[model samples]
Target: TKVADEKTCIQFSIRRPKLPSSETHPEEGVYKRLDVAAWLHHLNELGQVEEEYKLRKAIFFGGIDVSIRGEVWPFLLRYYSHESTSQEREALRAQKRKEYAEIQQKRLSMTPEEHRAFWRNVQFTVDKDVVRTDRSNQFFRGEDNPNVESMRRILLNYAVYNPAIGYSQGMSDLVAPILAEVLDESDTFWCFVGLMQNTIFVSSPRDEDMEKQLLYLRELLRLTHPRFYQHLVSLGEDGLQMLFCHRWLLLCFKREFPEAEALRIWEACWAHYQTDYFHLFICVAIVAIYGDDVIEQQLATDQMLLHFGNLAMHMNGELVLRKARSLLHQFRLLPRIPCSLHDLCKTCGTGMWDSGYIPAVECTGHHPGWESCPYGGTVEAPSPRPPREGKKGPKVPRDGFGFRR
Candidate 1:
């Protein structure tokens, strides 16, 4: 099948779900800066809720105010413990800063030959990606923007700190949002470490990890959006492999939404209140919401790629989160969830178990979401390039999507 180009994909209209507001559910509003502080104060005064971070986690699930995300994210990313006091947190920050500096010093102390080899092997890619990542955002808009250089430095230092994973394509995309929030290079580096440690999507993920996530996404689609699942199945092996969704999952929908909206979605996923793999439910929500075009047009693999690829900022982040939350709630309520679904839920963190289902809880970038800058220009949502031919249908290059391993 011939692949559609940007002009063609832009002409294809897709449905957008109704955007929900705080008025829709009185309790569904984001947790503000003061509210975050109060939550911590109450924790200290009351001395541990029965479930430890249960109340805090629930509040985070609703969403966090952009004003306080810098404060709250460390907890969500596991950089700071929920139980730590102000003094303890301060002390830990000092320690982490020292450790980060030591790593930097070690990098500086590398022999000239060692430094040259490192640049050729890792720093080159980091430099290339940092420049292109989120250039549209004012924070990273200028060529001389120190934040850009900071991103390069953090990723490079990370490569030194963890030689095993070294670096990969999506690492910069993951780091940019954290750096924007944390603001400090050293702290951003550590929070990023915490993030990479917690999430399966970043670094050089093992093929097994990728396969497991793809399987879960497929099974969840089957359980929740069976019709869409069947439509994809009809498209053949590419559909079944869900290579398109890999980009969605790998970058955590950063490329799929605008900068501000994408950050909102990210913190909610990091909350992991009901499930660590909430991002998977997000993938399901997107397909369920956006798949009508693919199915109705009978878009073959290439066309489907063009259709979804063009859906970046055009998508309503709130609507996607709402649908994703509803899908998660419904899945939790199911009387008999398949073991595959249950196991999938358990893969990353605590999720609803087979033990009587929890009744309910409500909640819910830039380049904003790109590693290699899918936009390819200043446009908010640029059309994606046509897929490259390979032995296994259309495939993005390893560096482009970062799933080589």
Candidate 2:
């Protein structure tokens, strides 16, 4: 291999496998429950793909002369620090505080009819039957709501609000985050619908719109998770389309991102006006960064249902978002990503947004996150995928932290 001086450079490439572990506990126990500590240990070692590369190169090329660059030292020191980007992120947060304050202030001045018209144009629908599940038992919850309606009414109004991708089942979950963010449920739900429509489809059956979005997602999954795609194919179209991904396309980030977190994310964009790129970048990053791990699990289980059943779990939200943002930062470095936010406006108008709401059959039928992928194929009990033949990553120890199937 050529170095700058063609010295061969002892060129060694390290393809990180997951930290090695032994699953010798053949028959005695259950699979590893989610272990954050152990997982972090593994991640610290395995995910150091960037750090290790830098360290190794410095050692090889500069030897002792590699006097650590002082300015670069902080990033180097905090490479694995948990507060990864907290300072800059906080600055974004401060800006959001001001924007949200203004949005709330503007809402204060809207007349009742004007408020109704504003939401209606945005496509919000509020009726009797569309109640929210989480709010059902909390009698005190909606006291501050500007408009009184059943959770069903609230949800349905949202469906109307974003007719491009209407009434997906899990859409309610997306609202939870926003609902948490806003003191007024009515306002929160409507704003969420507005935000969602801006990012993803909201269920319009008109002109094959839904189908196209479905197909696009399906194709992306094919590239991102072939085995998972195969599993969805095994279940037939209806199962995959109806059960699994209903809420995903409709609510977009509203469903998956929690409130405090959602506020954090939305606040940054409100300040910097960079939400569109951030959301798209994070969405795609999920596909790329976690693709291999998630795919491996689904392939092993061969159970789409199982895949979806545990969707909400497994993720460390703050950490995952950190990785997603990091990846987005990297994306900006690419020629294709964008040289400036200036180009982002032109590109969005004609590029991805104009592509219309093309849908794809996402591996659904489960919950969200990583769970059983029932759409994958018919399930065989207990063990789904074949035994580990040859694979990357250490064999996660059974009954412990490293235990990943």
Candidate 3:
């Protein structure tokens, strides 16, 4: 069995497919999956595509198929990059396995007195969430299901792996889908790491990181939908708290959308071809989609919370994706973006707001940082900038649900 598994991993490495060409863009309004042939082609040309930006473009336009998600998500998450050769990738797989095992061993070896309170908190928090992570989904449902045990092991191990951000409430929600798809414990662990690395602000110890994200989300609203921003502001600082939108940003809307649809939304956000903050744009799209209802109904803060909370398990993922794209197009056409916002874009390394438009070259192969993609292209490091000082808003509780105090 060991030999067979190694052979399978090697085959996956060598026969990795190339991303579909731009000419193969899915028909308008169609959601195309990355098929077998396309996957094989991408693997064959992994080295060449790494030299360019084709893979990112392909994913941006067409998400990976559910069948290939286990294979494709690793690359998307930067577990593997375009530049890795078949041999190098196999080696990486082996090394990653050993590293993950070591992390698990360390957790076992620790004396209870060494990290008692911290480990207990992590274990208790994770245990509480695991049973409820996605109980409605068959994958995690049932008493004493093996899959549920797998989820528990991975989350506990993750807490040990990254102690800095140990076991936040929504982390289980974020990891559940990856575990459902990847199935393998180690691969899922690494993929979850990749995801956290991309959205680390969501789980940072400092409230300032989350605060910055919320501030940016608000600014984005003010820019793209001034009326909505004004309406929220008119409600006072508590209203501007945007507690409802926090989980959408924090968990990438994983809790709000159904299991399958949440995966689709994540693939789009992970593509990062449109904007680094495309997920934020998706939030704006959601608000825009239901904007009329809020306006006409004159929703107070409590009422707004009720409305958004109810939207969970009820959103149209495709519609929200389409509207996000439309909003991006509209944002690009603005005459001038504020320098502060541009600085924010640079800090996020989205490059979307750099010129108030996505560069045409992003679809082409010549976009900036193509060379550095493998080393650090997944999420661009924010450039150094002066500290931003804005009128401080009221602090909201950090609970996963968005409800102001």
Candidate 4:
């Protein structure tokens, strides 16, 4: 098996596809507050409407300025449509405000017994997670901070709104950044809703959904980094399953990158300029760029987990993003894309293949990493408890660290 794998690896390396043209763009600075106005100005003019494409391209190349991130993220997250006029958006905002108020009122209107049931069931989990979400951020720091309470409120409302999906542990991590950016509770709630509903990465993850994504990631690894894939496959199902990337896919790298850089990465991902499955490329990029030595060292599964865990806040987000973009370009240029890959692309977004077809890649039936998805797993729902006094990271694995099962 090793000999055949090595031969296959070499064959893949020699035959790796390349793009016909490798055009490059100059590094433009962050899209500033003025740029937002410019885009909106074009939108307001009768004959001079701006294309969402230009804005998405700008964000894909250069990230948005922090000053304008709150303004821009709504469009990126699909909270606000690009075609909507200021007047229409104002009406929409009023409508949303009313809807939010109604949601809040539903909580107020719950019977004493119903309230007890909710607190015992849903709000209990939200309270525990919100306090730990981003306590280190100044906005959420200190005792009895109003922002913390606001976060709790927004999350509770979300639980009430989305009772079927309910509150999950990583949700607070996702909501905290939006709360910090948007500041207003109603807007934050709406933005979080948009994020959960629209984006591919953030979801009420099911075990099947996560396994499907890992399978796609495995195929991408096999295609782009054959030697690494061969080494992983040699280690049996544990390696090929890429369980270490669960955190990356589940939380969208919130714990992996620095706070600012994580925010930047999220916006770039939400831009939807290239592919909805860019998060998969990010998974590939991390292993490709930093874990290149995994195959060389022949690290086992646990050691690989430890190595990736230690990369939290240490990775260059910009560099990983660049590598991911390059890998996507390479995948698009492949001569005969595999059928499974085509299925992945079509499922993810518009298929990126040019033409030609090939049989699906084959693998052993010993798939691992199927314990449960980050969302589908049974987590202990801590009872409604007091917020922790000081700042601390979420109690989950940051980058596949401390995850054993």
Off by over 4 Å in 1: 1-11, 19-61, 203-207, 347-405
lDDT of 2 by residue, 1-405 (tens): 212344322222212222111311121122232134322332343232234333322321222111222212222223223234446534544664465455555655669996687566432433322344345424325654433343444465544444555554555554544444343454454455454544334443343655645654554344434455565676566544624443344444444555444433333232222223444433443444334543443322323333332343333344444444443333222221111122333333222221232111123233367465533321222232222323242232122111111
lDDT of 3: 0.66
Q: Residue 243 in candidate 3 has what lDDT?
A: 81
Question: In candidate 1, what are the lDDT values of residues 253-371, reduced to their tens digit?
Answer: 88899877777778768777667777888888788778877767777776677788878768988878776766665554443334344455545345453243322211101233445
Cα lDDT computed for each candidate against the true fold: 0.69, 0.38, 0.66, 0.69
- Write one digit per residue (lDDT tens) for candidate 4, span 199-301: 8787545646777788778777777777788888999988876767889988999889998888877877887765777788888878877775567667778
Q: Which ten residues in a row have the lowest lDDT in candidate 4?
A: 10-19
Worst 10 residues of 3 by lDDT: 396-405
TM-score, candidate 3, is 0.76
RMSD of 4: 14.4
Model 3, which residues run further than 4 Å from truth?
A: 1-31, 45-52, 204-206, 347-405
In the range 1-405, model 3's lDDT, one tens digit per residue, is 011333232110111122222212223244356666676676654332342245555665567778888877887788877667777877888999999999988888887795687557788877788888788778888899888888888888888888777787887888888888888888899988898887433554355677767876787777667778878998999889898888787787887887777787788778766467777778887887766556665667866776777778777776677667656645544433433245344534433433333211111122365553322222322332222223232222111112111
Cα shift from native, residue 240, model 2 (Å): 10
Which should have the higher TM-score, number 1 or number 2? 1
Q: Against the true structure, what is each candidate's TM-score?
A: 0.78, 0.38, 0.76, 0.77
